[model samples]
Target chain A: MAKIRPVGDRVVVKPAAKEEVTKSGIVIPDTAKEKPQEGTVVAVGSGRLLDNGERAALEVREGDRVLFAKYSGTEFKLDGEEYLVLKESDILAVLS
Target chain B: MAKIRPVGDRVVVKPAAKEEVTKSGIVIPDTAKEKPQEGTVVAVGSGRLLDNGERAALEVREGDRVLFAKYSGTEFKLDGEEYLVLKESDILAVLS
Candidate 1:
């Protein structure tokens, strides 16, 4: 239960760890791995301003797991905890 | 010259290398490093479908270097080269 309040249309995400090992039982190195597809939404901010300048309501609430594309966020760490701040639009799907 | 054509509203970006040596004169390890900022626009797809169902024209053309948030894309490597496909909306700003 990390308290990370994202700013603007940002949402703080804790990326899930890679759990699958290769057929040879080789754990993938961090450098060779891709961006995590799934994340737990720790906190969500008020949605981004629409082109008309009105702040839209956010679609996903906090604690909802979501699917987002890689390369959609500005990566950062808070107190040694890795997280991503992405625009709500970047989130493709919400995991039930 | 690598050829990478993104699909949908996706744009393929070849991330810029981290080149700055720290004050410690040490190159940061990849595992400890963050996502790349600058990128060369290798290819761009037709814009995403708008709410109206029409394809929006992309704001960025191919070959336009741009800045994007780290968590904004789905990362992939093509033929050993790293690239990211992101929705145009995920791009934070265009770098001149």
Candidate 2:
């Protein structure tokens, strides 16, 4: 259960896996690879309001798998769970 | 001199100081502290275009200290220089 839903076109993302084990199942180090680009959408905001007196609808719906920049969004904790609040535009693509 | 000026409204930020030595001049470990919230605006992209025939103005200009989400930028290296390109709206506030 979500404690909060994004209020204004912001999305909460659960980061994707960041570990990769070798064929021998040895874990790789963080410095050797780039961060993950995928995430699971946990919460979505109501969309940002424009100066023109209109609110834009989000292209990506909640529960969608998405591609985003590795360093975007505001990170915070909800009930001890970490989540990201990203603007709808920050979402790069909705995965198939 | 800057290698690139942000185009539009995406501002590039240099991460602020992340370490503080104690009164004894001993360095503090990263695990003991939260990340920095301040950054210097290096490059800015032209503001994101609105659906209407308009481009919103950026509130913060280059060389300004700004507050932004730690997780809200697409990190990339240009000519071996690290930078963050952020939408003008992503900027939380311009520090005085």
Candidate 3:
């Protein structure tokens, strides 16, 4: 992977793989797959600057399994792999 | 309006009014209106608790003009007026 570091409150995520088959045993093609909301955190920004000029600490860290908003974030490609640059707030939950 | 107190990073917002007339003096119908992405903050939730049990303060406050994601938040009516309950993270920017 390329050495890309996200700035304040941004995160780099690798989307989870799509399910190959449906619950009904129907083979779902890539084009028919819904955008996956689950991912593993790859990188995290330092923190967001607060109104008082303090750096607000990020809640999530590297390697966390997180669920994010479906349409959130900007898409980019790094070293032939796809990644998303999203605000830490876009993450809905962290899976245990 | 109803007295609502959002919990844990949630917020109440009043959407900006839609434009009624076009620059050409033609009235734009309500049916053709787009969802407003700008609004004024009405109420704010207490800060979200962090992993270490610290409450992180919210970035916005009541009466702040904000821009939010178009499809974000849960919509409901309060005393015949509409309001949205959104996570503080869903707010994109605070306008000056």
Top of the candidates by TM-score: 3
Q: Largest DockQ belongs to which candidate?
A: 1
| Candidate 2 interface CA RMSD, Å | 10.4
TM-score for each of the candidates: 0.42, 0.43, 0.47
Ranking of candidates on TM-score, top first:
3, 2, 1
For chain B alone, what TM-score does every candidate structure achieve against the true structure? Answer: 0.70, 0.65, 0.78
Candidate 1 DockQ score?
A: 0.05
Model 2: residues >4 Å from true position, as ranges? Answer: A19-36, B1-96
Give per-residue CA lDDT, model 2, range A13-93, as digits (tens): 876564511322334356745443677787665566687636677778877877776677665443445556677777887
Better of 1 and 3 by TM-score: 3
Instruction: Indicate whether candidate 1 or candidate 2 has the larger DockQ.
Output: 1
Question: What fraction of the true interface does each of the listed models get right, in terms of native contacts kept?
Answer: 0.05, 0.00, 0.00
Worst 10 contiguous positions by lDDT, candidate 3 chain B: B20-29
Worst 10 residues of 1 chain B by lDDT: B20-29
RMSD of 1: 12.3
Clashing pairs in 3: none
Model 1, TM vs. native: 0.42
Q: Candidate 1, chain A: TM-score?
A: 0.69
lDDT-better candidate, 1 vs 2: 1
- The candidate with the higher TM-score, 2 or 3, is 3
